[model samples]
Target chain A: MARHIYSCPLRWSDMDAFGHVNNVVFLRYLEEARIDFMFRLAPGDGSPSFSGGSVVARHEIDYVRPLVHRHAPVTVESWVTKIGAASLTIAYEIKDPDQVYVRASTVVVPYNLAEERPRRISAEEKLFLQEFLAEEPAAV
Target chain B: MARHIYSCPLRWSDMDAFGHVNNVVFLRYLEEARIDFMFRLAPGDGSPSFSGGSVVARHEIDYVRPLVHRHAPVTVESWVTKIGAASLTIAYEIKDPDQVYVRASTVVVPYNLAEERPRRISAEEKLFLQEFLAEEPAAV
Candidate 1:
């Protein structure tokens, strides 16, 4: 029931012509945070099933406030909102202490890359993810 | 009401390490199709208010099938899903003749870039957008 925190560094190219981080680039940040939480921090000794192969089935993101490029890193907090047999939903907030730039969620499905098919969540993997389980507001 | 169709070309870089288009890149395709429908094809011969300024408030996208990099362009169909006083929703599909790769929707709020706030839709803009009005399935 704890959240995963990632300090995501901002890239100069993340900004768009508007001089603010482009809405699409926010997904890249979420991808990075998710990779850290699932691949690096999972309980497995090495090569978690998630690292083997996974697919993004869906994404819902809301832009709260515009952000400009800065040298400092921003905080991305993530937690599991839902876990089904074949898919899981991870929710995230990209923010500072006082303000939030984005609220988002992704539905991810485990896949057997070699077999090219979706797979059920492994017990070991589920146990690792269960530690971060929490509910999020309804996804958009 | 007609759908705005864009022949969206794929870049080699659009594919991820998985050998399929990165899920996030699909948003860029939707952005392109929306820009064509609103900024280029809107009735106004001159720059439309959309070009002046607008913001993406929210996005919901679902992946239907994986698409590999191809020389031929894919088709992106877009239409207005909802238009409120201060916000509008656009629905899109990235597809070929027989298959759909993604389905998505975006809620956009017109903005006064200088004033830094949302603005109401104009009568002329509403009239033009009405021709493509469509209600999509629930956004995930």
Candidate 2:
């Protein structure tokens, strides 16, 4: 099981009046990490990329504790939880060096650009994601 | 009931690789609208002005559709859903004027800054919120 950890700087706007990182901002952090992971592993330049499709899906997030905005950086850990025939479940945990801040999971379904609808996960994508899919709690 | 409709500009950073506003970004929009509403109604100097001590308890958002990043502005419609002894539910709808984009709801609980725990909703706050909470839904 391979895990990708991406770190991002906390901008001043990320904080709320409580002097804590606004809850919604966590999603943006997760998105950046996930996109970086995909680009690194897949490595393609196109609308749908080498997989011949795009991905879209839903997400669920649970806030574990408040994160204070500080000069310190935040790290996001992302991994594929499950890989379905046409969709994949990815799980994420955002934390500082000491404690966890939030846990989130998303379901991404492959989309066919030509048909403009969801398509089956390609063999190449499955192979590429195999390293991530093999480890820990299976995808839901 | 006084309903506030806020139109916010979409920043380039708000769009993901999919060319749509990332799902997580929607939450920030909601926060901005909530803060603005609070300040407009309460009339404060905008220094983390929720002196009443309120925190978000739960949030549920439905992605009715995707919002593309165009030059057009996005509108966020917000109103009080229900007010309880210690909690209040605020509902929101994000649209592009041409169509419905997303619907979200959040439950906020009053907190005791001194006690470090949630407290009962104040009578004054409830009374102030009543006028905005009693209105029926708009004809979308």
Candidate 3:
């Protein structure tokens, strides 16, 4: 299971009144990481092709600790937790260099553009995601 | 109980590759509405003065529909849902002028800045919130 590490710089506007990165801002960071991971595996252009698109079904987030404003960049680690016939579960860990900040999991379903409904996962996508899942129970 | 309607312009960057406001972006919009609601009720100068503060505990969101890109403004309708001993639940409806976009609910826990933990709701604050919750739910 190889992990995909996506890094992003925190913008000034991302901070809230408490001087910590706003909780909602983490969702944007996570989306960027997920998009990057998908492009890495499939190697698509910037636009998301809809021939077979993906949509989020649900998201479960646990903010273990608040991320404070920092000079250094933050890393978002993501991987497929479970791949089903028509859906997949992706998990994320957001952290600075030393400490883990937030953890989240999202359920994504593959949609067939033609049918306008969810479709089964392709063998190719399953193979690609296989490289990222852990052998035992996945963490973070 | 009068409903406070807060309108926010959607930035071009708020849209994702799907040509709609990203799922995560909705959370930020909700936060803005929540903050604005708090400020309107309490009428405080913008500062980190949390001698009496609040934090979000749990959020249950429903993506009933999607809001597409448009030049028109998006309206966020927010109101108190329920007031508890130490927590307050707020409901939000994000919509365009004529149609519903999304529905969301959040639980916010009041905190004492001095104690640095959750605290019981004050009589004055509870009365204010009760008035807001007494109104009918938003259309969106």
Highest DockQ among the candidates is held by which one? 1
Better of 1 and 2 by DockQ: 1
For candidate 1, give the lDDT: 0.90
Among residues 3 or more apart in sequence or in different chains, the pairs in candidate 2 whose N, CA or C atoms overlap within 3 Å are A81-A139, A82-A139, B85-B121
Which of the predicted structures, 1 or 2, would earn the higher lDDT when compared with the native?
A: 1
**Highest lDDT among the candidates is held by which one?**
1
Best by TM-score: 1
Q: Residue by residue across B1-140, what tens digits does model 1's lDDT show?
A: 78999999999999999899999899999988988877788766455488777899999999999999999999999989899999999999899999989999999998878888899999999998899998785653
Question: Interface RMSD computed for candidate 1 is what?
Answer: 0.4
**Candidate 2 lDDT, tens digit per residue, A35-95?**
6776556645353543455554666666767777788788998888899898887788888
Quote the lDDT for A16 in model 1. 87
lDDT of 3: 0.73
Over the stretch A1-140, how does candidate 3's per-residue lDDT look in tens digits? 78889988888888877666877888778878887887555533343331347777666565656677677789999888898888888888888778777777777777665566678777777788888886423453
User: Who is ahead in lDDT, 1 or 3?
Assistant: 1
What's the residue-level lDDT of A140 in candidate 1? 38
The TM-score of predicted model 1 comes to 0.95
Candidate 2 has a TM-score of 0.71
Per-candidate local distance difference test:
0.90, 0.73, 0.73
lDDT of 1 by residue, A21-105 (tens): 9999999999999989877886553554887788999999999999999999999999999989999999999999999999999
How much is the lDDT of residue A136 in candidate 3?
29
lDDT of 2 at A35: 69
